[model samples]
Target: MRTHRKVLVLFAALASALAGCSSGPNQPDTVAGQFADALNRDDIAAAAALTDDPTRAADSLNGLYDGLGKEVTFEVGSADRNSFTLAATWNLGPDGKNKWSYTTTGTANDTGDGWKVKWEPAAIAPGLDIGPLTYDPVYPKPARILDASGGELMTQQVVTLVNVSQGADTAAVAALIAPLAPGLSAQSLESDLAAAQGKPITAISLRAADIAPVQAALETTRGVTLAPQTRLLANDKSLASPTLSGLDDLWQKSTAAATGWAVRVPIPDGTKRLAGQDAQPTPDIATTLSIDLQHAAEDALTPIAEPAAIVALQPSTGNVLAVAQNAAADAQGPIALTGLYPPGSTFKTVTVSAALQEGSVTPDTVLPCPGVANIEGRRIPNDDNFDLGQVPLHTAFARSCNTTMGGLAVKLPADALTNAATQLGLGIDYVTPGLTTVTGKVPPAATPAQRVESGIGQGQVTASPFGMALVAASLARGSVPAPALVKEQPGVADKTPEPLPPNVDDQVKSMMRETVTGGTATSLRDIPGLLGKTGTAEYIDDKHAHGWFVGVDGDLAFAVFISDAGSSGPAVEAAGRMLRMQR
Candidate 1:
């Protein structure tokens, strides 16, 4: 028994000695854990203290963190008495989509009083060489914005960049160039040239097509140098510039550092796009625009010096055929599809539909048409307050009798216009990947006057040119055809079509045709099968009105608009021009 007790005592002593050797105040794993915590917390001084070359390693870690960008987290993956590995993940702010993750491993050894990392470049990045590193971001060729006919609406085009070097006359150079590109300001060019650094003077970048009209004159101009550069853009004076500008933003966002981040390599030329090059692969998204119709719509707005927009749609398919906006309207951000404005008397189509459904009026039903009628004590007047005493509903609509329409509003519910507008594909709830639109707005009325106003396409009744075109399309097709700009399988059409009252479509069609024959829209008489409504919508203040024309001609249905046009004459003229061009 005494011998067994002695053996037990000896084993306990050996176990204690082994435990002592295995752990200490400066053990490898403990040191590594502290280092990782310090690194993660950005405690440069504390982390440096744990390394052999304190200052150098801390500086290295600082550079590493700086390269990692905004957010980064660190963890000690594996640790032991002699070795440890750390895993780190970094996010380069919102500007970068991808996160970078890498693991760093290093050895640890006892140095008299404590354990320290055998610091080396590999401990920061595996196989990292001598010297600082730089990140070079690479950009891909912007994708082409194509139309339904597979025609490129916005494509890669060459442009000329004019530069004024040392001792050059900025005014003379700008004067020569301004005639070629009207948007370019000679005074601004002179100012820019005066403030230029390495490059003497930089002028506006002119599209090759824009400069072609006066290439002869530009060649003869003095004190300037021109260089050809390539970029994605629309044709000169095209309405697709806003769309292209949006695409350019996407391209900028898609850019990132190239793979296998290097210390030294020749950077690639950004304009060597994969679009036309066989050496690389990229994307080109297809949309449902029509280049031919888009140009026709642009030509239609040529005569209107004010801000104007025109949109065209295929009635059977609801595909957007064209979206064109005059230069004066471009600042409004693709107003053809996104601008919201009161529809004015053009909204009577919806009001009539509601009235027919509610059994309040019919084509044969005769209604009041005084020069001015009072609805709920609010006075309502027709266009120029022209009275057509006691006319049929059909004749009243054909003549755009606002006073007569106002009478029907007093008989219907507040949501009547809202429901009718929704049923007609206005204010449709939908989302397209790379498209924008404002369907329409028909808010419920709080007062009889408001309801009467809504009846005449005023008050809360609003629409974009795109939205008005859809309403015209729905009336022409006898059902609400879904509108789409992208090739979507079960897209806008999948939305429930608003049921129209029986023969209501036919009645409205007849009245619209009558509008061209002997009504307010008589300007469209020369356009065969042209059935339409003309509106001069009052907006902003008393005298400011917007011109609106919505119509259907054969397979086409469209809307034209001109801001502050006072009357629909300009819109009608633009519509006529579009029809003639399309024909």
Candidate 2:
């Protein structure tokens, strides 16, 4: 009976122990683990239900996650009846590969009911704040727009923007900005101030130099606040404005990816650059342009307010040395490389070359230089009705005799001019990157008069400054050199349909030299070894003419075009300036 009683006591004690172990107290770790799973699933309601302050806790987690949130996972480190700690890992996505791990703690207390957890912002991320989280985008310093010589064309600098606030004195803001930046009209500012409907905003932007003289006075002026911002500016605005615009475009394309930096703070004043990096570093843009030459070109055009373009190229390699256009011309777009203008008398170079190649004429072949030559019943007269009389084909070319060129076209086949122009680097398209250009157009003539007009570069033959420069370059190189804007830019120039007679190029160059020496281009006679031709193209109903000069000196070849120029002298003078400015 004693043994049976002892065995029952032992069984009872064992059963009570098992019950005590199985029915453990609600642990903080269990709550914490459940909470972590709820957050991972984005089940805010369930996660908050387990916390002390549901609304406040859920809000904090939401703010911490920002957009699209992330994945959450936790490991219970150590736990007790009153408190427990955990290690949480957050992933920007469900991918565990991208994770940020942090330690968090929670507390649970039983008040005669089920255990409830104490939640805080730190439970999501340590030191997590209650306000909305924002990422400020930071941009790297603008990469330099470099010249061919690796000098800075455009660089980073400080600029001031006068901002206006509607609540401030309206009259004072206009008066302050007027003297500092004369380009910004005071009348327009007053109108803007009166018309403004909202809070403070930028009214006008000015370079630091524009406001330097009156900076102190402007600073004391009321109602207008000066906000200094960092941006790219040309080293000399007068010299590079319009050209810089194109190079600026190329720079923007190169650095587009590098500008996506999102930092912890806003872009501040005098902040030269942002510290945070988002992408590959910006690559400096290297160009075939010399800012020095560009400055000279700009200076040359400053006096002339008409539409004009100058294109300079190195004859040895066909690399573009400089491209500049007056503001009036640039306002119409990049006319220097792409504008279509009649080659006019400059086409005589091509026509004479074709006539010489086909055994129709020779450098010494005497062609009639009548004041007017009838071609298909159309009267063609030389400029100012002056004739070279009976002279060699070369002399007729030197004098830019329209009558002789028109007569020469009458004997040639229609495609002769077209084929010849293509051989001289015209009537073809290009796909060079960062280059906006058109080669030229020389359609085969259909009528006898059409051929005559095309012969003198008038009827349907059109060429850009780019094309004319290439004509001079082909004459200089004896063969057309391939044009290149960027040093390693990939492209190929179209081949001449058929090769020119070997001697034709030599004859062509001699004829060009005659023009500059004893012919129509007397303005360039003083320029030693100056080989060129001049053209006065009558356009716009013959009311005005566009002056053109294409020339070569040493390894440099260039073309100048002036809109509405009464004579070719202006273009000749500009070419002279360019030649003297060459280093």
Best by TM-score: 1
For candidate 2, the lDDT comes to: 0.73
lDDT over C-alpha atoms for residue 222 of model 2:
60
Worst 10 residues of 1 by lDDT: 1-10
**Worst-scoring 10-residue span by lDDT in model 2:** 1-10
Deviation of model 2 at 534, angstroms: 0.7
Local error of candidate 2 at residue 148 (angstroms): 2.5
Number of clashes in model 1? 0
TM-score of 1: 0.78
Model 2 vs. true fold: TM: 0.75
- 168-235: candidate 2 lDDT, tens digit per residue: 55456556566655656655665666766665667778887777865786577665688999766777
Q: Against the hidden reference, what TM-scores do the models get?
A: 0.78, 0.75
How much lDDT does each candidate structure score? 0.73, 0.73
